[model samples]
Target: MNETEQRRATQLLQLARNGDAESLETLLASYIGYLKVLSHSQLDPRVRGRLSASDLVQESLLEAHRDFTKFAGTTTAEFTGWLRKILVNNAARAVETHLLAAKRDYRREYSLDLLRQAADESHARLNSMTAVHRRGPASEAEHQEDLTVLSNAIEKLSTEYREVIVLRHVEGLTFADIAIRMNRSAGASRMLWMRAIEKLREAMSNENHE
Candidate 1:
């Protein structure tokens, strides 16, 4: 969300708050990619194969739509925070539902607070990946746009490339741990991670150019 996007969102928020259903839909639709990134970050890895991040994002968006009138925020940050809370709650429910169906003990493995913490950590990791660290402190909207750009770039990566980057950076896995998870030698995992970083950088560069 840059200045233009923030202004547009504020306008839409005003309209949606005034009972403009179409504006509400458009506003929610604009956040699909952003929410998907959050969903992917917050989703428990054990259940990822069984549940798609897009599904969780859709569920969150639907809930947001139903409860739009309850939203009282005026700024984009407030609105984004509200949406993030919805996404986390929906993710928790989805994870619990799947784990229970599989007869697994979700209580021992997951919690809402943990999910929220993970989301924050993931976003922080993403922020660190950007030029924001070299520049001075970025505005909240700039940070949001950077995350969205990085997420979209990650989505364009090949499966193995994406997995290595996510495991090494997003999940903070060591080379040895990543080797075990990726079923490769430690050295091989290191090489793969390096290559993955290169590809991710390329993808992100392309995203910026676009």
Candidate 2:
């Protein structure tokens, strides 16, 4: 965390702890995007419809706002990790409360057709990415393909892996930054990233074969 961020975080925590409502809201608003992305990545594909991501995000924000007291000794990694925990926990609760009460939807079938389509979409996205996304810039057609591949790859990642990847890679936090947000040592963050990459490679390979 930078000096400014550290100060702001400290201030927010203190305010929230003291029951300063607006300050708490401001603090949680700053982190809402990260929460939404985490929730999306964690959702099971088998489920669909009426799953309110925004509501879950709002709920998390409210809880954090109220319980900021418990979140003392703040570090950048711990902030992200705590946010992640809230999102994952909320998702599990949502599934149990909504989906489990009803019959299994079974609408999303995992089959050759869906897999091939996913692979094709992923390859296209990869080919289309800009200079930074897929190693380097590409021609217009390639750029579009790169985006398609990237999107598919992101969706294919497991929730846990996706959380780290989004924060560190997509959100552009450094390894140290990621470690702090994830509440892990730098070594663990590095290993998690390595594992995420390995999973991506496996996903890509499977796409190619299919």
Candidate 3:
């Protein structure tokens, strides 16, 4: 994270902890986009009428706000890690609830086999296509299309794997920053990240071959 982001995150965390609702929302806004991906990755996109990403993010924010006082962190990385944990947990709960609701509404449990199958198909489509994104308007359509595939691939990855890939690749965070974000020792983060990259590469290779 940059110095500005680091300072702002600490400020927001402190202000939100002090009961400033605006700060809480600011903090939430910073991470909402990623959390949306997190939420979507946990669900079947085919089931489009389900809970919205914003709803899950709002739920996460509510939960985070409730215990903001208990948060004791000074750096942006620390705050982000905390926020990531809360967001992931909230998303997991929302997914569980969605599955349950589906069962009640349709009289059958959500299908795990179906979800896994969807994830695999998503992975395959992502592999056959290129993955790219431009930072500014100068980017081409092909770049955007690449990004979409990569984004989907990132989402379908497991939680631990997803975090590593996004932080290291998509977000372009340093190993140190990722280590901080994951609240792991620097050495451990590096090791895990290497393995995660290998896993992603294997997935991509398999995706391309098929």
Candidate 4:
């Protein structure tokens, strides 16, 4: 992060720790986009209509705010990890609540462990998109920043483009699977995937320039 970002993060962290709700909200806002992408990528496809990614992230953030006093972590990494755990747990609960209550018979149920595994796999794929050669704390920080940039870029994409890219990369779905999920032919899904990659590259370039 830049010096300004670091200073803002520090100030927000301190204020949030002191029971400042607005500060906590501001801190969480910085990550809302990232969390949305994670939630979308990991959400059970069968239950997506009933569970929105934004809603899930909001619910998780609310829980985090309510239990702020219980958090012991002081660093940015620690904070991210803590929030990720909450998001994963909330997602798992959401799937169970919506799927079972709705009485929909799916091929599988989303256990907490499975949710976490999916999140980890998606995060790994996200990290792979911004691969760096070095290995150290500095490299890790750069990687995280790159991910944030990429996430923002993805968020800027059109829904169709974003959906295709996320399914193809983050969820590791094949063209046939994505086609079925998107209600498109496999050839059309491949075409959309290509377009999405082109758009993603353009978005990243624009972000870099800005």
What TM-score number comes out for model 1? 0.78
TM-score of each: 0.78, 0.43, 0.41, 0.79
Tens-place lDDT per residue, model 3, 30-118, is 55544555445444344437666567667777777688777787655456556556755554455556555555643233444444443
lDDT tens per residue, model 4, 1-210 = 344344355567778888888878777776776788888876776667888888888899888888888989886667777888899988777777778566655426566777788888888887777764236444434555566668878888999999998898788899999999999999999999999999998998876666
Which parts of model 3 are misplaced by more than 4 Å? Answer: 1-7, 18-21, 46-48, 100-210
User: Any runs in candidate 4 off by more than 4 Å, and if so which?
Assistant: 1-23, 102-108, 132-140
lDDT at position 63, candidate 3: 79
Question: If ranked by lDDT, best first, what sequence of candidates would result?
Answer: 4, 1, 2, 3
Best TM-score among the predictions, by candidate number:
4
Error of 1 at 154 (Å): 1.1
- Local distance difference test scores for all models: 0.77, 0.57, 0.57, 0.78
Give per-candidate clash totals: 0, 25, 2, 0
Model 3 vs. true fold: TM = 0.41
**Residue range 117-173, candidate 1, lDDT tens digits:** 777676566667766424777665566566666777777888898878777777678
Q: What is the lDDT of residue 124 in candidate 2?
A: 32
Candidate with more favorable, higher TM-score: 2 or 3: 2
lDDT of 4 at 8: 54
Q: In candidate 2, residue 88 scores what lDDT?
A: 61
